[model samples]
Target: MERKGESRGKTPRAPVTERDSSRSPKRASGLSREVVVSATAVKTANPLAEEFDLSASKSHGQEPLPVSFSSPPLLDGLRESVLQALGQSASPTPIQALSLKHLFSDIPEWRQYLLASETGSGKSIAYLLPMFHHLKKSELALPEPTSSTISSRSQRAVNPRALVLAPTHELSRQLSSFAKALLHNIKLRVLCASRANVKSTPRATFTASKMAAQFTDDADGTLGMPHLGVSRPVDVLVGTPNKLLEMARGRRWDRVKDETDKQLAAELSGSRSETSSKSPEPEMGLQNVEWVIVDEADILFDPDFQESTRTLLADVAAARGQPVPYTPDLLRSSPETSTTSTLTQNTPINYPFNLILTTATIPPSLATYLDVHHPTLTRLASPKLHRLPSTMKTEYEGWTGGNKDADIERRIRKVWAEDSIRSDFNGKRSKILIFCNKGTKVQSLGAFLEGKGIPNVALTKDSGARNFGNNHHLDGFLRTTNYKPKPKSSSLSEDKEPHVMITTSMLSRGLDFSPDVRHVFIADEPRNMVDFLHRAGRSARAGQAGKVVVFGKLKGRGSAKATEMKKKVGALRK
Candidate 1:
């Protein structure tokens, strides 16, 4: 019998390989090559080399180009943007190369991909580059808007061609920034909609009325053009789920029409008109969206966010006139039946948009969820998915029964002292990241470290604590040693002391810290291997040498749990 979560006709996960010769470029001697202008001379240059037919070259006698195993063949515009964003000498990581190969293929089979790679492995660029390339191509194929239609188009409802959803506002903003960077040469417009963009307000008091008003009064005094400004139909939208959901559902303009009709009726009858009790219809902007990316898929699919994510998917499907795969109610009642029945009834569902789910780690729950819900998603995972980087060293400190705060303080000092001795320390303070399981612990530990004269910043899910954009201390700490912040009388100098950032797993998934963060301190035992991997992956990123110090207790069952965790970590390395 098959597994409970496994579907009957699911495609087996396979390693990414070049597609058929008709779609993919022919590889000579099992290597991909691209022609570029070169002045270097070749001693035995064969004008008629079998491996690389130089006769195809426009030039009469150009040398055989070296095979590029790192950089995959991409569109000219995308290639330039990639090199520009990641430096000319930099090349695509393993995940990036494989993903690009699959995405760049001309196979028109309604592709859905789940790109799982190790953290800091350029997953953002891997998806962003191809999405941009495809969108740009589509835009070019369309006829230019006439002068008469330009203004009308700008005032029309916001309809983005591509949408990227992130779990947190921070990650969403970061993804938007990266997307903007990739589009530096391209003309596509990238917009980020998150709570961060909205003015900070109490969640309970911020109702739909306030949101509608805010969106109305903000940009040119228009209704739909307020929040995002519909300046030009957004090309690519990056936002958190809640924010994107609101945008996708859109606002009700029928209220104005109802008010006008009621006034006219009152004038004609010389009496008040009964209010229309009909539900206001929503104008959807996601109808034209061709690409939908859910970054950090594991977190979004968790129970905490699963409902909203499912609703968003259903809304997108509805907008595109496709059958709803699974409603929230159906999933709650019977997920296996709802998903299987919806998908199996239709042998192949041609979704209007391509769905791409990117994550650093895929836990069993997420795996089961994907297999049951989206069995057709093609997975492109890296070889180093669950493993800790080889450059990262792990150290465990056990506390039998003592002041945990004091123990943490001592370890912080020890790490600082050790960092001071490094050859590249150069009298500059190093950065440390501390992960805690709870927000209360994060705050208390931050206060304790401050009392101990250790400069630190606390980041939590609380809106007040998460305003890192305005936190100069966090800005200074995350900046490089050469970074110079504007002078402030009350600001603590970042260079004078070692900076430690105390945060929950909120910063663990896709956020990138500075290279100065050489040490990661886990104040509490991670709940699982995925948590541990993400926490440790924050450091030792991009081939940087780093260390991880995990603190645990030795009393009662703590010792056994700690040992088991260590073994799991070791197994991941293998």
Candidate 2:
């Protein structure tokens, strides 16, 4: 049976694979001193990496330093399910431990922060805890809506207490998974806008198609319902900007009702008992959101999403003025409590919700914008930008193979040859991640590897879509790290031959790869320092020792741009 909450379309089934016993393990090899020296020419380590002692020190390195708690400080209030989801690894990462201390510290008002941390430093968990903390507290303090100004159902449907905006569908889905874990066994409902329901072309066409589908009673019954803005009950919502706005505009719901209410009322009088008993669901909106988080704020503020982000911010800002509707029972029983000095109607509340923006990189314009809009934002930066993790051994080599395809094929062969030997001797599979600049290259290379009988997959933005191909790209690549294979899939089995993942920037940052990744092959040099850092970050994650190889021509180590980038990287390391 299909899961109750699963969205439309079928999830692709992963392929099966069998090992080739002909390959034998070879002795592990180390980089030559000359190659090591060249690679270090552009290495940069994050200055903040030294701030906290990775071994025994548990306190956050800050003014009001966090006292070492027996366990994660916020674990007490979190649901057991959430804790269970976190499992033994619940101990906070350095970034999470430090950010939580200041973010949740006692203050006069809600705190605003701009958090910059290294990739895979547990940034998601850092903000997620605080969001849940605030929402649980608010749910207790605030009464349910019962205002005659709007239907209780309608108000409840459209009002989301917490809003999280991500740049991509995959990121939003990732956030939704974490949010669900934290909300386990709780009354709250978390909604993630599926990419399938979202339309990007012809605004009018999108509106018409969405509304027509939603007006019916038997709509998919998921969050995608266009009329859901004012009708469905969603406490936490994670989505891309354009899709979010499509579902957030409550006025559209009101307009729908205004046009249909009369006809519906007439039909109710004439219809049979079963039909008459049914009523339209409430329209959805973002009326009383309490927290707004922009994950990957740098991407959210980028040119591609900037306009939609501005519109979303404007909508949330407008929703702020209207207070949360109160239940009649609470009003009658505790008028004084409702109008307490802290929450008095006369005393203006600061902007309706708390704002948190998180990213590894904050562009200058975004910095300027934050300075103006959220002047009080707590500036949190790792002592320096996160450089490559120390656990990774960097390597540089020039590509002597003629032509692009030849260079790529040669590099793949070399890595596979070395890894095969390591696998036989060490009994450990060497998961390799290869980086390419473009999607077509990734696909072509993946196809090429398949032809060579090497297990490989290509992951990109389109890979996450429903109709991109029949292959299960996202599912297959995600399992590469944890070794959790779907039922009857020999390819995902740990005993199966080690698989290689060829990808673009889509899998470069934020997304977690398997700790088993033994090597990262930079088929193409990153364009800049930031790209270099994120690419290198793909390996040596969570303190695991790994290797990184940047290939170039035999005469020259790496591309011209890569050489220049290396110098800047070397300076940062120095």
Candidate 3:
């Protein structure tokens, strides 16, 4: 096991070369020729840059067509029902405003979109509005279920037409919640893949026979049910890659220990595809997926998830016996003959799924992968994609005082002791978020702070951790903040809040923090420019004032990274 600061030997990599904007990206590693739209830097006088205007610019001389945000049409492309559900939070973020046209349009040329924007820029809504719009259109266009043709289509168990893959369990849940809110009254069921089971709050009405046909009680007597039934089809499935695959292949709900349960599982699984009179139908997951979206693209490209990620993509492509465009030998050479044989054999090239990949930071590796896998990915980026918002102020606190871990802690202590932070707090419990490089450091630093009488909590993954467990300590820590108790829970004044929260980079990407967060501290130096930006982004969200202090030397590796950080921040500060 590698320690917090330990390093695995770096793999030798090819030398890097600078490319010009006029030239297309290199087609390396099985990359084929396809439409490529690279990111272009644009500036505007307004804080939120104007939406992309493709109307030939009013004869190229009429002042470039001023863009405005007005009311009668608060947002375009969304139906009135969706707009009503959004309520007061209906205004489009910068990312949403630019992408909505392509999202809902049926144009043949505008199917795939790649979003690279900052955290909290509303990337979820960008893809979701289009997805829901498509689903709604499909729902409306289908003939009434009274018709035998329509009934057959509806009765064929719930094969999700829209699938969303997230990197972490938390991110998957967060994305699913947003989707459910937007889907408010739409006759669609959202499914989340959990360990050994699928979760869905049955929004669509289903007959008892149909429900019983699709599920069976496990050994624990709890129903291990599939997300969809004959009466209702799942419109959206949001889950991590592994769990999503398990549901797609019909293995997550298998309860062979119970004879009745075994038969029910087989019946539900075989309903997707019928082979012969004697042979049962095969369970082809994702056979009907029309839209497959991968969120947090950079994390999915990590070494740990690379192989499973590739296999999942291959399976989706081959779900309907379609010819995969770029099937690598790694996918075909697997020792598991059953899986490999099914994935490689092709009947015809039927590409039913369009891919949408989004991330706050696009590393070079990810950019290269896009060049190969999603050659036609239409790149749309926020003007502030790589920069901090104007409301966020950054302070560079170098390790000038000392060079050891103790020195880092002392620097942090000094910053919290500053009168300016106190002034910002004004005798209220300080809403501060501290970030560390690894999980172990998060726990250690959190315990250290608690030992120093600064009440705190650690939110890292469970290891030897203790505070996150059920106890009075967490309650006391919550009292220090403005956390309100849920309805019908124990009644208390609810004024207490923790002085500080120490956590790992897991919270850096897409999770929303409380609006009261006024300050952020980085206890350990981040590995990349993207890490730094996301860490600082946790605060100053929803148009609030926030400050971030970094405790590290702005030299050596930090020097180049800091320079890039400054350049990006300066661009948005304009």
| Candidate 2 structure lDDT | 0.54
Candidate 3 versus the native: TM-score?
A: 0.66
Candidate 1 residue-wise lDDT, 331-411, digit = tens:
232343445465443233346678888887765455545444554566666556666777899999877456898888888
Predicted candidate 3 versus true structure: per-residue lDDT over 12-33, tens digit per residue: 1111112212212221333332
**Which of the numbered candidates is closest to the native, going by highest lDDT?**
1
- Residue pairs with backbone overlap in model 1: none
**For model 2, how big is the CA root-mean-square deviation?**
16.3
- What is the descending lDDT order? 1, 2, 3
Poorest lDDT segment (10 consecutive residues) of candidate 3: 54-63
Alpha-carbon runs more than 4 Å astray in model 1: 1-73, 147-157, 197-230, 250-284, 329-350, 463-474, 477-498, 555-557
Model 3's alpha-carbon lDDT is 0.53
List TM-score per model, in order: 0.74, 0.68, 0.66
Q: After superposition, how far is residue 480 of candidate 3 from its true place, in Å?
A: 20
